[model samples]
Target: MKIYILLVITSFTFGFLEKVVSNPSPRPYKAIFNLGDSLSDTGNFLASGAILFPVIGKPPYGQTFFKRATGRCSDGRLMIDFIAEAYELPYLPPYLALTKDKDIQRGVNFAVAGATALDAKFFIEAGLAKYLWTNNSLSIQLGWFKKLKPSLCTTKQDCDSYFKRSLFLVGEIGGNDYNYAAIAGNITQLQATVPPVVEAITAAINELIAEGARELLVPGNFPIGCSALYLTLFRSENKEDYDDSGCLKTFNGFAEYHNKELKLALETLRKKNPHARILYADYYGAAKRFFHAPGHHGFTNGALRACCGGGGPYNFNISARCGHTGSKACADPSTYANWDGIHLTEAAYRYIAKGLIYGPFSYPPLKISPNKIA
Candidate 1:
C-alpha cells in the first residue's frame, strides 16, 4: 500500500511539473518606472500631500479594486497598474511613499494627481496660477526619479544594467496643461500651449534616454473632447462643433494635434537613438474606441457620461465633484467608461490597456517577449 501511494504521488508531481514546463510563464519586467499625471498616478498625490484634490483620496475612488481610495483618480486601478500586472510585477509604490529602507528593486511610480507637462511657473508667469492645482509637473516627477537613481544603482555600469531590464512609462501627460488653459476660456492660450507642452514631453523623454533607459512607452493625451469635464465646460449650441459621438470636435482636434506633434518628436528621438526602443502608446485611440462603439465595447452606460459625479447632462458638476458631498458613484462602474468627470473607470482602463498590449491601439504594438518587452 505504501509503495502504491508513493508511485501515485510521484506521478501526480511529475504531471504538474510537465504542465508547468509546457506552459511557460510570460516574460516579466525587472521593474517599472512611471511618470505622468492623475491618469497614471498610483498614489504620489496622496503621499506628497500636493494640492488637496480631496476627491481622489476619499471613498468610492478605488472602490472597484482596492476597495478604498488609494490616491488614484479612478474608481479602480489605472492602465499602469494593469500593465504592471501583465508583466507579473507588483503594483508600483508611489515615489513619495518610499523611504530609505524600502526596497527599490520592484518598481516606483512618479506620477502625481493634477500633474502637468508644463512647469507650474509657466502658468504662473502667464497669469494663470488659479487654473493650476499642483506644482508636481513632469520636470518635478523626473527630478524625483533622478534623486532616487543613486539608490537604485551607484555605478554607471550597474545603472545601465539595472535600467535596461526596467520599463519606463513617460506619459499620458500634458493634458492638464491644456485642461487649465481651456478652463480659463482662452482658445488662443490653449492653442499656444500645445507646441511647448509637446516639446517639454519630448525633452523629458530625451532626458530619460540619456539616463540609461533603453525601453520607454510614451503615451499621448486622451480625448479631452469626450471627457465629462470638457463636455460640461465646452458645451456648444452649434451642431457642427459636436461630433456624431457627441464629443466636442474642436477639443478632440486639439488633442489629436498634440498627439501628432508628439509622434513626430518621437520619430526624431528614434532616429537619434538607434539603440533604444521608444514606442508611442496611443491612449487617445485606445480610449476613443469605447466612444465610437459603446455597446460593442460593453460600455452600456455610454462613453461620455461619468459613472461617478454630481448630476448633469454628463453627470459631472464642477461644484460637486466625485467624492465630495452631493456626489455619488454608480452601482456598476464596469458599464461606464468615464469614472469621475476627468479620469476613466478601472474597467475602461483595462480595455484600453488590453488594446495597447494586444492590438490596434499602439503603434508597433506592445509585445511581451520571452524575457522582456519586445
Candidate 2:
C-alpha cells in the first residue's frame, strides 16, 4: 500500500458541503446495519455489562444528547445516529439490546466500543490486544452478527431483501487497532498492521454483499493526531514535528496513509463487484476541517481539550479518568470538539455526518437533503 499519499478525492469547505454530480439514481435505503466501534455504537457496551469503563456506557458520556448515560462514548448521538435519523428509521439498537420478536426490519448495531478490525489475537501477538477494560474485537462482533441470523430474517429471500434495502455501515473502525498500537508505544508496527485490518474490512464487505448487501458505507479514521488524547500523548518540544493545526505530523500522516490504502481497496472492490455501491466516507478530511474552524459550528475556545476527564492541559488524565468522583466537565459540552479526550463531541459528530451525507466525499453521488436521506 502507498505511504503518506495526498488525498485529493474531494473538495470541502468548513460546515458546508459542495455540490454532488449524479448517475441519476440512489438506493432507497430502508434500514441500517452498523458494524464498527464506539463512534457508531448506541448501547452495546452497556448491554455487554462493560458500563464500569465509565468513559462509555455511563454518566457524562451521554450528558449532551440523551441528557444522561446511554452507553455511547461521547456526550451525545454518534454519526450513525444522524444517518439513521436521516433515513427516518428509529435509532438502530445494539444487537445486545434485542429482547423479543419485533420489527428489527430496521436492523441492528454489532459494534462494541473497543473493537478492532483485525482479530484480537493479532493484538495479543503484539502484546497490545489486552482489553484496557471491557472488550470485544471486530471479529467477535461479526460472530455475534452471524448468530443473529435466525432473528434478522426468516427466509433466504427475506434476508436478501433486508440487505438490499439496508446500508451496511462498516467503519470508523480499524482505528482501535492503530489506537492500541500507538498507546502501547509501537509506532513502527503500524505500517505492517494496516494491510490486515483493511483486508478484514473488505472481506467483510464481500461477505455482506454475498448475503445481498448492495449499498455500503465504509468510513475512514478521523484525524487521530488532533484528538486531545494523542496531543497529550505525542506532544513535542520541537515545533517542526507539529503541523500548523498543532497536530503531530507523524500521527496524522499514518491516518492519511491508512485512508489512502482504504480508498484504493474500495476502488478495487467497486470494479470487481461492478454494480455494488461501495462508498468511502472521508472522515479524516471532515474532522481535520473541524479543528480549523470550531467556533463556526458553535464550539467555543477552539480547544481540542476534552470536555470531561481530570488533570493535564487538555483536562485529560489517564488515571483520574472521566466519570470518576473528582473528574470535571465543561459547563457545556457543545463548546468542545472531543468528549473524553478519545471520542468526539456530539457537535463534532453532527458536522461530520452532514459532510458524509451531502458531499464531494461520497461517490456516484447522494441525492441527499441537508437533513434527510434520499
Candidate 3:
C-alpha cells in the first residue's frame, strides 16, 4: 500500500507585466486559468459558506494580509494571487464569483479548498464517505472551466488567441484524495488509488491542451512527512518510521512516489504534445529547504510547530480548527512556517514562491522566453 497522500503548494512563474521579477522577461500571459485545491483557491470554499465544515472565511486566515478570512487557507495571498501580482494583475477572481467579465482578462481561479483530483465517490469507496466533499473534485472544477470557456471567446480565432496566450495552473491536486484515505485508516488502499488519480490529472491536461492551452505549470504535492497536519494525524513513536528530521519516513516516501509518477506523466505528455509547454514545479523541494533550514527564511520555530492552534507538538488539532474563537494568532507569523496545521503562512508561501520563480524547480526556465511585454 502507498500509505500516504499528496499536498497543495505555493509557486510563481517568472514573466511579464509593468514589472519583471527576473531577468529580461518573457511576455506575461494575459490570462491565468487555475485548477486545483485550497492551495490555489482564492475564495471558493468560504464563498460557498461551508464555515462549520471546511471552516474558513473568518479571522486568523487573513490575519496576515487581507485582515479577514478571504476564504484562502493561508493567512494571506495564495501563490496564485502572487502570480497575478507579479505581472501587475489584480488577485485572480474565483469562478464562483462570476458576475460579469469584470476580471476575466486576468484569468479565473476554479480551485476550491478540499478539492480532490478524483471524484468524491472515490473517497467513499476508499472508506472515507464521511469526509467526501462533492463539489470540490477536479471533475467539478473542470466543469466550471468548460463553462467559463464559452465566455472567454466567441469565434474560433479568438479562442485560439486567448488560450494560446493564457497560462494554465493545473494542480497540486490528488492530495485530498489520498488525505482522506490515510486519515480514514485505509492506507492499504493508497497504492491502488495512485494510478487512477494520475490518470485523471493526465486526462485533465489533455482536455486543457485540446482547448488551446499551450503553457501549463503544475506544482506537485508538499512534503507530507513534514506537514504538521500529517505528523499530528499520523503520530508515531516508532523511531524506525521517523526520519532524523522527525518526519515520518514512510509518509514522505509515499509523497515522493506520487511526485516521481507525476513527473513521468508530464514527460510523456510533453512528448505527445511537443508544441505545448508543461512544466513541473517541485513543491516538495521548495518546502524542504524551509524545513531543513527554517532560520534562513526567518522561520525560527522550525517545522515541528505551527504558528497557531493547540494540541500536540505540532500545535494542531483536528477538532479545534483554525479561525475559531480562542484560537490565537502567533505573535509573529513570519517566525513560523506553518500557519495552522494544514496550510502554510503567507510568509512561507512567499518564500516558497520566490524559490520556485528564481530557482530551477520551475522547468523550461521561467525567465528565458519573452513573447512580448504585456
| Candidate 1 residue lDDT tens string, 1-374 | 99999999999999999999999874646889999988899888888775567668888989998999899888888888888887878889999998777677878999988889999999999888987768999999999999989888999999998888898999889988988878888778787888899899989988998999988999988888999999999888899999888999988998999999999999999999998889999989887788989989899999999999999999999999998889989999999999998989988998988877776777766667342222
After aligning candidate 1 to the native by TM-score, how far in Å is the CA of 27 from where it should be?
Answer: 2.6
TM accuracy, model 3: 0.89
lDDT of 2 by residue, 1-374 (tens): 23323232232332124333434234467778889988888888878878447456557778886888888888889888887777667788888888786567787898878778887677677787464434576667777877877777878898887777778888878998888888888888998989998999988888777777888899888888888788888888999988887788888899999999999999999999976799989888888887877777677856478888887888788777788867888888888888888888888888887888877666655446424532
Model 1 clash pairs? Answer: none
Candidate whose lDDT is highest: 1
- How many clashes would you count in candidate 1? 0
Clashing residue pairs in candidate 2, if any?
A: none
Report the CA-based lDDT of candidate 2 relative to the real structure.
0.80
* lDDT of model 3, residue 291: 85
Over 4 Å off, model 3: 1-26, 51-54, 367-374
Write down the TM-score of every candidate.
0.91, 0.88, 0.89
Error of 2 at 55 (Å): 4.4
Supply the global lDDT for candidate 1.
0.87
Model 2's TM-score against the true structure: 0.88
